[model samples]
Target: MNENLTNAQNIANIVAQEVELMSALVQLLKKEEEVLVDNTPDKLETIVLEKNTLLTQIIALEKNRNSSLSQSGLSPDAEGMNLLFSQLSTSSDVQNNWERLLNLSSAAKENNRTNGILINRHMVRNQTTLNILQQNDQTASVYGADGQSRVNSNSGRGIIAG
Candidate 1:
């Protein structure tokens, strides 16, 4: 099973990198939320494209994780990358899909509905995280370099911390 360990380790490494990338993208999305709440949509098209790419990366990671498990005879830990992937299965797909509904550019995508759902779910979770930070008066601590607090405000949506 050393080979399996090596393979699992390799896949785990890739999964970890992808997970980090997704986390950064999620942070970017949260920043976009802050921008949308306080600023104009001066370059929102770019945001949408970037958001789509993040979703693609997330889905790709999920597929890779599952494939690795099957190929390496390694049952993924229930709380490891599998758990991270599970978070994506939440409601963000709805929001992302809905966003596409308003964008003619995304109308041609077949998985628009699924993506809308995922994005919405993701935003909901992000908002919840911010809310917890706020309720505990930890906004400053969470918003490193004023990043957390500045981006906290969801413009009355109460989803953001600012």
Candidate 2:
């Protein structure tokens, strides 16, 4: 079981390093989101596209990870697969993959927030349209002033009446 224990220690170290890398990437992504908040819609599209590519890679790696762990059971304990995984454990590829995952997550969140902004804009526009139509219809009616839009007979200039 020494081999398993040793492999476990190495795996644990890899996991810890991966976590740290991912965390740093996450913080960077958050800063990027803030920077992109004021960006035009087209620029945000580029981020989303990049995020999607990263997401594809992250998903593939995640799928392979579990299989790797299970198969580590059968890999030669001191050579071959162990060396392969050991080298990869500290390699730039793993770090990059985690970094990409963080970027994708943050970009997805920013996209959702942007969608919310668009929805609110549409809702406000629709309401303004409705109010304008109502006023127009009221002004064009039989009694020139009968349906004149009622101004808030009460103070409505942002005064709290309650």
Candidate 3:
């Protein structure tokens, strides 16, 4: 029983860490959305690096949790978690932590999906702009009524130009 309690505490600690990391990830996703909306590329690399670090931390915590579960003769799956929760007498705290982790994970997934959609929309819009610019022939420059060279209204390409 003491061993189960110790394992449960370890599992709970891991879950708490996972929850924190997921929450950080969600925050980073929100920051990414801001960066996307504001069209700030300079700040994006930092956000990406921070998010990667958080992911690495989360993965390591999950590995530790899985090891704890395996030591308890659990299969390190959802079923294993459930079994461990049932076997641990002081499992209420662990269960609560696990639930919080799950909620944060779900939120992170949804926010990430939203960011992906934003990126795709941006890509399509940029692609359309590029297509317009590329289709315009440089030799076909038109002269304005004042005899000055008329600028191509659709010409737009930048660092992300592809």
Q: Please report the candidate that would top TM-score against the real structure.
A: 3
Task: List, residue by residue over 29-142, the lDDT tens digit for candidate 3.
Answer: 999998988878799899999999999999999999999998878898788898988887778887888888888888889888988998898899886775465455545535
Which has the better TM-score: candidate 2, or candidate 3?
A: 3
Worst 10 residues of 1 by lDDT: 98-107
Best-fitting candidate, scored by lDDT: 3
Q: Give candidate 3's error at residue 56 in angstroms.
A: 0.7
Query: What is the Å distance of residue 121 in model 1 from its true position?
Result: 16
> Model 3, 100: alpha-carbon shift in Å?
0.8
RMSD of each: 20.3, 13.6, 9.0
Q: Count the backbone clashes (under 3 Å) in each candidate.
A: 25, 0, 0
Task: Score each candidate by Cα lDDT.
Answer: 0.55, 0.52, 0.83
TM-score: model 2 vs. ground truth: 0.36
Tens digits of per-residue lDDT, candidate 2, 1-162, equal: 555545544544454454544444454455445545544445656556655665555455444444455555644322433454454545455444444545655655675576567657766876677666565576443323444545445565675699
Please give each candidate's TM-score: 0.44, 0.36, 0.80
lDDT of 3 at 139: 55
Clash pairs for candidate 2 = none
Worst 10 residues of 2 by lDDT: 74-83
Which TM-score value belongs to model 3?
0.80
